[model samples]
Target chain A: MKIDKQKFPDTDGFFGEYGGKFVPETLMYALEELEDTYSKLKDSEDFKKEFYADLSDFVGRPSPLYYADRLTKHYKSGKIWLKREDLNHTGAHKINNTVGQILLAKYMGKKRIIAETGAGQHGVATATVAARLGLECHIYMGAEDVKRQSLNVYRIKLLGAHVHAVDSGTATLKDALNEALRDWVTNVDDTYYIIGSVTGPHPYPMIVRDFNSVVGFELIDQSKALFGRMPDAIIACVGGGSNAMGAFYPFIDKKETRLIGVEAGGNGVSTGEHAAPLNDGSPGVLHGARSYLMQDEVGQVKDTKSVSAGLDYPGVGPEHSWLKDIGRAEYVAINDQEALDAFHTVTKLEGIMPALETAHAFAYLDHLPKDFDESTNIIVNVSGRGDKDINTVAEIDGIKF
Target chain B: MNRLRKKLDHLISIKEKALVAYLVAGDPDLDSTLDLMHLFVKSGVDIIEVGVPFTDPIAEGPIIQKAHDRALKNNISLPNIIKLVEDFRKVDDSTPIILMGYLNTFSFHKELIDKSDQHGVDAVLVVDIPGELSISSYGISNPNIDSISLISPTTSQERIEKIAKNGSGFIYYVTLRGVTGSSNLDVEEINSNIKKIRSYSDIPTLAGFGIKSNEDARLLSEYSDGIIVGSSIVDMITKQSESRNFDRIGEYLRGLKNAIL
Candidate 1:
């Protein structure tokens, strides 16, 4: 089945059977307005020039695709290359989407910007862009995440954005998302919701994916320039599937490069505590989009536990669901312990302290197919830095300070 | 005809405003909810909107969200709520019952929704799948069960026409620009939007969201066919959950009902 990667989310915003405008009537107009305006601006030369210039100058774009010599030797199978999205401004690929969205907010003449965050990387990125653009920004994060990722919270606050600590329903990513949606519903007229991932209703998943696809497009150029060919496989972590979708979108039609999305496996999938929705959950409507969600028999979203806050969500992006259903991409999970080990190993081997979310992708190196040899070239997306996760790692290591 | 349509027509013929009372089923327990349903009809509630508790009620405010959380914590399921409606029908069959909830709960239990009419449910108001996307879109094609749709202050004229045309039973006109339980009733806005909705279709438009106080009910009922009070009533149920004495809730319901009449 040759799927047209470009002709997705057909007008009504459905990626196959997933992704639709499953929101309240109040938000329908706002989404339609956004859709209309985005359609006009997305292809305009002015929009492209402004967006690319900002990406190059502000975000330090074209983040190097460095060959991981030590890690490749350690793996003794695939030649590992790292797409260093971690090197971008604000220390994550989150800035890439935020920059693009805040630009859209500016063009739309929205006075306020609201977003939901899990790891606080996206929160920090949104705050950074909102500050630069001089827009009123509010970021909703789970109360639990506020404590775990305190550094990023402080960074968001320092960047002049208000942080709302949502204490409802496990007080994590999904709950934060619910709170953010409520805020959007209330302030739909003057506010622009900068959804941090490729999830949510209609144009949001499409918009976020398009903005972040720069990562994959750049990888295509860098791989050809350095390795003389496309990668054998591309791996990235999926939490609402922003970075992975960004890295995989450009290669969906390129069948030679295998796309793999690593989900957080908390204890394990069998424990019913992990956040790997595509791997373990069923198809259901959640957070305004029909996607794979970790829900129970009665359709109540189940609680998900993960060491990484970013990957601790019960849902993934809808496009990933479509990709998985079509067998265009492979979905897998990495347990917390394995991710932690990879965090330490990657830091020691490559001197690159990967975020726990990013570490999940690196951890999959050990599980690569035995057929992969030195001739196989694999690129893993370092989606974010670990500076925000230092405290979490320290507590797990029993180092209180 | 569905009970909801028949009741709405009867109310309109008599020039009496409809009072739609909303409560979370199984908040205290399903038995209490059944009792409350009886009590609401006794207090002149023309219709009953039973909230089917979901894990995430995004369109709800803190009051109703908490009510949903409480009901869910009590281990309430769609089947349990459907059974509650069945039990309610054993005593009272005149007051139309509408299952109000997010789409996931109803979509997940298509079998239950398929037989909801026989079980005494007249309509379903799914918060997520609004407009042209009805309960039938989920494959639960029960012609006897009406799919209620919402029209808000932010809804455009074009959308109002589409939503009002697609909807059945009643057009829920959200009184405010916010979620359920949000404050500030724009009477003029409500009048205009409801009039706009009525222009599109003859379906009865009921004003809801932030409809507290008899004055709000009186003012909103002047424009629309009826008023739907949710958060304030849910708040009352939460306060009186311990004693299970719903006298104040009944009094409040009667107060709004009299104001509308």
Candidate 2:
């Protein structure tokens, strides 16, 4: 499908009927300030030079696009390649966005940085950038997530960022987000909120998507250098839909490339315990954006369950909602067991441990259309490394360590 | 004119300040909320802002957020709150009741908004969707119920013009740069911003958020037409939930009213 990327999120920051600035009046000035600064800086060559230089020198950009030969053979149907965002600094694709936003904060003369995290990768990434920039940083993580992802919490604290353990409303990503927003509202003047996904109100979804689109842009060059054409399909997991939107943005206009977003099916979609909003949820307003959300009949957001902490969100990005409605991309879900099996399979076969979030995309390979042959080249976004999820995997395996 | 405009006009004509008190409906239960509504009027509160409980109230502080949680625990929905308002109207016909909440809870129950006038709901203050976007943006075609728009300290001069011009009932001037219960209200900043809003439109401005003490209400109402007390009142209700002894609440409201007078 020939989707126009620039046309979306109109001046008021909407994508079709979704993605408006549904925040309190207090944050409007800051959002407008950010939008103005970003508009001038996004096209400035000086800004691009600085941004790309940091990506190359600081974040270790051009993260390798490697072909997973063993995984392809295991699948026995099509060629599989991985966008090795795990190779980036901070060991996740989240740094791409943090690196960009930290620079934005600096440009906007903000001295403090605040972020909300679910799996801790984004928190670690934001902390890493804030440390380098010498900005006061605070990260809000759900109390449950703080306990689950303790290593990342320690790392963030070690990097001089304060971690506020939020214990409200399901005490997960959504709650953490609510706390971060409250903090931002409280300290709007000095604090710049670095939202870690393609969620939240306008400009954020657009900004995060633009920063992370380096993944797809790099893949375009790498694919041509290797396979001489775009991949037949691109797969990435959708939590708040940042990574998937990044991978899919550059290919939206390319008719030949198929975009597939995989969501975490904790138990199953029918069981209503999953985080697959696009697959099983309805359109509603949450977190300042109108999107498909796991909400009840009365519009209260539902608590979502997922083995991957990063994928446990009640809502998807509004752009993904638009893409789904327009039939520009396909969204599917993979259960916890299937994602776990895929994690183990890829680690054994390819000698690479993918993040639980990324494993969802890899798990979808088993459910691919039967018509795909050996010539078909599929690229999956390996969003992060699995070191943070080692304890989760161990607990499930009944290992004390 | 609607009941809200009439009440505010009457207050302005008499050179009296409006004391608007906010309480989450069904915090302890719906019957207590009704009793509290009558108490607010009896204690000389000029207007009552009934908080419609929502799951995630991002604009609220811990006190109001906890109140929402307590209300939701009792399965409090928007329709139930509207019904509560209907029940309130059966006894008190003149006092203007405004439903304040997040956008989704009210937007999802558009049918109630359409009939809000019949149920004696004079206004709705949706915290999330402000300015150019109103309840009509969500497909609620009700012309009777006033849409109260908020103007914060951070609002630009240009936006003040837009919001002030578009808003009805009154301009909700967020006194501080924070959530409901945040402190450190810059009186000078609030005064200047309220003046700027008045320069744009003739709507009555009500300063809310962070107005805790009667002194705070007295000082803020000196600049604007009225003052709205939210988190502080909600906090009192939560603390008094066990005792059901709301005389203290009534005392606080009376103090605020007298201070503003």
Candidate 3:
């Protein structure tokens, strides 16, 4: 019974099973003129005082929710908690869905933005929010990811932007998302595009999972002020599942935490090798909707061997396909020589080097659930920064040059 | 007052004669791709396209690139072909999906082609960027999202008015130089290059590569405005995977989409 974006309003977000205006009727009057200028700039108190003074003086939210206390004394009873989002501002969590889609592309006046990357971390976070809101950027990677992320393609060309490279197909990141959807269907009137993940279509997976639900609404206000408690388990690493549904949709009505996710099981999931798409995928209907993929028997979309070019993608995330068909998220699998043996065991035990898509949540820390030994805490969501995978992890551990 | 008169304003109040089908999404898997897109939109198929499956389609041939390498040996990406056109727009939200792949799988995903205009997808052809170049050779905007473009038979007439003022859905015209499923159906030079792209724009100009029967979609839908077939329905699913008699090739593509509508 999905149809409920305020009862099929039909601005762009449909709601049948549930909805999908599926975008591009030449930006259907620029997304119905930015949903009528975000419903009259939500009672414009000067656009919420310049959107919370640029969300607390330009992109620095309430970040840290730390306490890994050395990976939680070997899960003695489980109290891990890390949610750093690799300390935001372009290092990861793709700049909280690129500062709310570049302030809805500067309230739809749209003076050019267009994105698409693979490991140039969301085209250097949409070229650092189109260079602090002045706008005019470009991106689109995959001439083999601008020659394997040449320093995030020179940090999206030192934040001025205009990158290109593409060379089409297997050049990578799904051909820089088909050349930023053929440059937003050939410049859908000015340009803004942005989509880096949480897969695509439908109000961009609910606006990049509501701008990465400010990382699970500040991990439920810092886990109810440090252990008055909630997360008995949450974990992350889903790729295209927008930092695992922005750290699992504000604790999805907290049903005793324990959620998980992981995926990417490349070289495992029985030698079909892995990008574990919702635990060895099946559901079908790729790219637009209907989830769980890693295809074959004829429904195409297969090449996913995940050395984690952002979890390589075959498919996953229609709300993680409605949280794995309503079990409230559990899906697993973590292969590719166990995410390169948890990326060389979390860079020689915690110096960090994480992002091989957070090495599939540290290769499923010995298959979760051990129950209340040290007061069960767990959170995970680390999200990025293995410094663009140090030359494919020093040439897959053989280490040279 | 133009863009194909507002894309046939919900098809000129059902005037008729506009069938168009074309396939290729995960080939034979995504649950026979949601039962061959619900028997190609209940066999009326007023526009479906889909395809996607690429590896190196380069103007395709060899049985639609072996049904696109059996749907990319089952990894069919372009966001799993726009999540199968946003799950067939939750059971057909007024037909019209379109997508046709390559151009580096929709340029990787340009925010899933501006979120495939909310997934009911009205158009996007690609097959090696052919015309107006979608906003000067790839910049994409989305005035409801249509980009079609494929002018061959060795395109000219001064590159069909610069690929018909940079194409925007309603001009594919290839008629055979070779590839897609070439057996060759040049039909008097495809009705003389669709009467020379209907002398530049009034838009609607279809015609795909090596079409194949119901007299090649009634001899290229009586000189264009329809006919895109695709390696004869991927050579009837490679003769239903070499005759295990797969549901009699969905009753031979419901007898070629009811003998080309």
Candidate 4:
């Protein structure tokens, strides 16, 4: 129950048999340099001050922990509290990590930054930071995503970042990730790979999680101030699980609090179209670390379909896999239709338009037991706003946006 | 040591650089892959690297990526590639065959190492495994199969030493700063790095990536013990698929060999 977050990754950056450096030989040094610099700077007061200053001034930190009274009325059992990361600058919690990494990049003397994104929130956030820092930025996005999320492509370009439409391997997040890695490998000297999630190899999962843990840290303080006690459970949608890791990490040592991760079930888990790796997949090494993945018998990563581009990945963060195996956290799935319904429900009830990805976590409320303790408060991470997803949602709903 | 070591040692004794050739096992077709393997040997390839096709190969450039797509279209899997090596071994067993691929393919086929060794696979070169990581850690290693580790331009000297220590068959010195098939090689930098690698371990170092012409191969062979050509051969196969002038592959490989010698 007592988890020492510092001792984790045990020098090699592993979380139990999960996270390890599974990158090319060319990237080992860059990761090592990052690991060294991050380790030294993370605990420094100066770094914390800068990060907090940015959070307060730029990202609008201390995102409110608002009570979803109507949603709780519909659920009938538990009181639901929403961690409004969707309220942050760039309309998502992704800015938290990008800001931290771009600062680290500047410190490391990296003049160029590269990133890969699925839903475009991370891409937009990364572009925003790179633009603010005046660093050369390149975002690799799948060609299919480029077509579906043209607005985000335009947004990234407008931020002065070049968007490379990747056409390899299903033309989705995984393919874009491969292309980004290729770009990183080719330009390791002057380029900083700003991985948008807590997934990549070693320090990335640790670093991204730490950078975003500001969300949970803020939640802890605000929850005590507003609710008189910590919430009984914390919930977040897990794509590569950056937001979930951010929210759950601060509570890792809080033994009494429950952590639930919701995954995109797509059509349904049985139909094999889901991105619910933790719920229905097996342990395998993917991207750069050992994690739960939607891979076939031969270890070939399977194609995943989800209504939300952010949750359409075949792999989950390595720490989530470790947490799942150790029985420290619970994971469940929400289907696309259920998420859409929740999207509509949250928008109508709370007047808060939830990103389709965040809707998965909101959708989990409908599945909670009716006899569950009414006194226990549940905090769901509304990780992003739905502005970027408006077109996709509109087209699906037969509304021409 | 295995056949790869033996082949390298033989080449060294004869004062010739080992000309290593790489080809995806099921590119174009399985039958063509079979023919290509023999052609590589007859055309003076000291070692033949057979790529097992997978849906995603991150380290590859556009040429090999397309080759993998073509190979996968014909339903090529790890077992079938190992079988292709088995078939290659039937007629000629002297030329070393290194099964090159990603870690997932090797890990998926549970008995890949045993199968590769039993079928006379001389070594294995997994693109993702850096020197610090071990193939044995994933339960993939065999005495019969020398696990080749890669050293890149960005690889620190400390890691180069570490990789050279663990590396078996040979240390593959990626001559370029990027993925496979990428252009731009600083031969002087590669020569110096190879020296650093050789300082740590006596494992024969081979230069690869962007060795397009016979001149490039000959130029690189002077600094390292051997050379490995991937994109050039894969590109030839792709262009010659319509020509079906598969002999051109042999001719090009022979040209690389003659230049190195």
Candidate 5:
């Protein structure tokens, strides 16, 4: 399972047949420029030095891999370790990518930064970096997201970034993405688009994944330093698969280690309301790449539902799709009830409030066998904090938060 | 020769600029789209473009996106769009027709590319697929159907030469560095780029994107061989739903045609 990075995504930015630049001709120049710049700078020692410096001082990288003692006892099977990405400056792993892209934008002399956010995590992250760099910033959010995640909208506004409410199809993350793409295509000259996840056309998926891979590399060293060995399995929630890819890429060549991606099974997969593209969708093109998408036969994107706005996307990252197709990774789904139960249980037992998206990963442990080898170790990526979802969870419980 | 090439050649022989009008199939409804096609011919449109509606059209602006939404609401698909062209062909056999859309619609059925002649489509312009990822190798280059390529303002000169060498029918030169339906046309830049592309190959180059006015069309036609008016025409068709009179669309087409010719 030795991953040959050099052989992937040949000159055209394809990972197998899944990823390509399917964007319009107007934005072709920007994508090509990004590709060339990333290729030149990705391996430079100076760039890495600067990136890691900010990751340490600004976004607080090398987040702890703490052992969840209570969760281990509850599961009664395997020892569980948590990769605490939630402790980052923005309370999510999204800062890892935004910080990298902002640096790239500054290096490219771009004066403006734009992004799309569903749960406001990416928007806050991008706005923070843009403010840090003193650049003009704009964020597109679906109107529905704006209503449900108003605190995030206020945070973005407080950071001096303009939040544009998109009232398009379904009024959600996909619509926000569509609007952000329009803005990028129209203002391609001065603006840098910082995609929030490992999705989109060529260069973006690769770029985001590269920026987030620090999580996996850190986890490898931290685990060996603490426990003297790599974990038996790694789990992360896959909403566009950025955080999961970040935590999984370094260990992909280690066949003995299991990479499990958990997706939202809202209601259930058979109910056709879930956002689990890897589980229920087919291969199609969406948002600029050919990936697994929830679409009708004639190729129109379908609406998706999930308790976590971050996971309510109809498509997944093309790299994840390629990985699933090749059997390099295993994907599973956790329903809303199970995830909510895990959210409450973990918060009470471990004294940590988990985001709904991250809860899906924790909930999967309940489904695993009640016993494992004594030496088995499992790592679960806690991608974000639960502060943003307090109102949502309270409303579901019929409490006035 | 394909009907598009023949029509362009005939227009060039007479020293006239070609006026291409674009309409979304099944917008408002299919019957009105048919009426608009015939009306385009009557208004002196040299060629007709039938845009197959898609859910995610990243390259299009508000006007075309709304048109696509309406078309989808009415259940427009590739087969139905081809049928609309077949119905249009029943009356007018001379005007060249092009099916314009994202690649997913055309790639959905391999036979759709093979049956272009039977469906009376002269050219296929898959907006998302660039020259390097040509579908011609996949049998889209059926002798009767010419596969089109696009050149944007940002396209490098070396890349233009390569795309032009492989392109057939016509090379669509995006007049602005923006999406369809966007404003701010720089006719001087368009003229210069078209001249540069013309130097690379013998294929005809047509200016499109943001050619909204008679002045815009007239100014752009002075540089390129023809002009393809999309958003402006589709915007007019969208207004027809309110006015319920399709004549204004023809009148606007005649105005654009008159300005160019």
Candidate 6:
């Protein structure tokens, strides 16, 4: 299983079992040509200048680290701050990775940016980047997800991406993933699979983290600017574990900032009603890499149920799994009802209607101790705006206000 | 000899092609599964592949999916599969029985696969797992049970060599690139792959995936050592089960006995 991980270059872009330049015997010459070009182009001053310039002006340079004073007041403890990724373009932290992948895609001379989305957030983010870059975009969505998340369907299409409704198998996220994989296998020549999360093969997690690490990069500066020091802890929600990874990566080197990952505890983790795979699962390989997974006793992956459609999954990102195993970060679960309660709590008490997915971190208040200090600045990644989830939440339970 | 080893070895020594039969365990009902299994062995089946239905069967065609849904609706559990195997052992013990399904369904039923030597199930064929990965590595820790692998016509010769070297019981060479039950095969490609497999290793190659009609089975029988028919037989039983003709399905299976032998 680890053999495949060994195929790639020793963190320098090798592909064999670690990773291969083994794209296709046909494209071998083209890829070799591209790699040679990339070596010279990668660290060129113009490349960095254009990339960082676009990131700040267009993609929203520095997402704020706003002190969530209300959460602190309610908990009657440590001061809480929210890294407002919700304020970024395309509504989630997905753009951070999408922006970088698109730039990398452009540098590779790839014409089409194809992606797979679960809750449709990543697809929209990728499509937004594709449109801005004047590249063709394709989004693969399971037919069932298309029906459930029709609004996201509209959002992706409005961004000018073609959505292929994956009707095979369970007609959900996994099927969408298979279709995306099929597309990659078929169109490897001209297409770049802009995976939304820090999952899929290799280079993806490493590169996506590099793009997303911007959050952690900004958090340190934001934390220092406001409190004259880095926060004691950083928290974020994990679907495929990208947003949490982005918020946690830079701080991984800084041992003081304890990292907490909140997975969607759908109905409940004990009830097997959540997508808290890392918390409840054991080590296994899926989508070409070893990671913690929600496999049945047969060791076959099982369907995970989470209140947040976004976090409902059977696997975790490889890096997140590694982090959990190494004890650098703690992966925890917050179930459907608890996330919903947190959603309402944050909305009413803090006037911020969090995405049902993001409310998982808010639900951590149940587990965290009540006493904290002003110096113990806690940063929670508000990964997305909740407008898209409002209607889905209303469909679940009726509310007057 | 082990049940799987005996079946393949028996056929190899006899200079006769093996006829491997397949059925979804607990389809329609558990009782019917037992009756169908017995009927399968009686009708010249050298070995049986008991399909353990799963929630997501990406490798299955429409026919098998329906059987899986019916089996799941009947509340078939992993224990039921073992119970079926145990019950089958009460009458007959010579015919090898291989438990075939997805890895999820198999992993949950590992205790059963572990006790397969005791229960008389000789091997397990998890349809979804590619040969590049091992059964034990995937958490199916039992060393006693043989892990059957499927090699498609689409699979490269190098891959065939790898699967053949590792595969025990028999090599299930899927006749088509598409899922089971789909028709219109390349008989030439089928024979070439089998010939290719023969060149690589001595593992007995069993052709399946689209072998439905007797003519189709008879045709594939010429190239491969064994034939496996799944969806067609399961579909026939399910169609008859709708009219409450459970016995008629068994009778119908009798008609296809010539297809295998």
Share of native interface contacts recovered by each model:
0.85, 0.79, 0.02, 0.73, 0.61, 0.11
lDDT of 3 by residue, A1-401 (tens): 32222332234443223223332222333444555665676457876576556655665766778787666775455777778788776778888788777887887778999888888898888898788877889888878657756878897898898898876446667657655754664455578788877665556766677677778888988999988878788888886778888888777667888678888777887888777767776754443444566666544456677777777777766777666666777878787777777777767766776888887896787677655557778878888878887887777778888
- Residue A85 shift from truth in candidate 3, angstroms: 16
- What does candidate 5's lDDT look like per residue over A202-294, in tens digits? 989989998999999999999899889888899999989999999988887878788999999999999999999999998888888888989
DockQ (C-alpha based) per candidate is 0.87, 0.85, 0.02, 0.78, 0.70, 0.11
Residue B136 error for model 6, in Å?
Answer: 4.1
Q: Report candidate 2's fraction of native contacts.
A: 0.79
Can you give the lDDT of residue A48 in candidate 5?
86
Q: Estimate, for each residue in B41-93, the C-alpha lDDT of model 3 and write its tens digit.
A: 66555676778876645455556656776777676777767777778778767
Arranged by DockQ, best first: 1, 2, 4, 5, 6, 3
Show where candidate 2 strays beyond 4 Å: none
**B222: Cα error in model 1, Å:** 0.4
State the interface C-alpha RMSD of candidate 4.
1.1
lDDT of 1: 0.93
**What DockQ does model 1 achieve?**
0.87
| Top candidate, metric lDDT | 1
Every candidate's lDDT: 0.93, 0.92, 0.69, 0.89, 0.89, 0.75
The chain B TM-scores of all candidates, as shown, are 0.98, 0.98, 0.31, 0.97, 0.97, 0.92
Q: Could you give the CAPRI-style class of model 1?
A: high
In candidate 4, the residue pairs with backbone N, CA or C atoms under 3 Å apart (3 or more residues apart, or in different chains) clash, namely none
Count of clashing residue pairs in every prediction: 0, 0, 86, 0, 1, 23
Interface RMSD of 2: 0.8
Per-residue error for A206 in candidate 5, Å, reads 1.0
Best by the DockQ measure: 1
How much is the lDDT of residue A88 in candidate 6?
A: 86
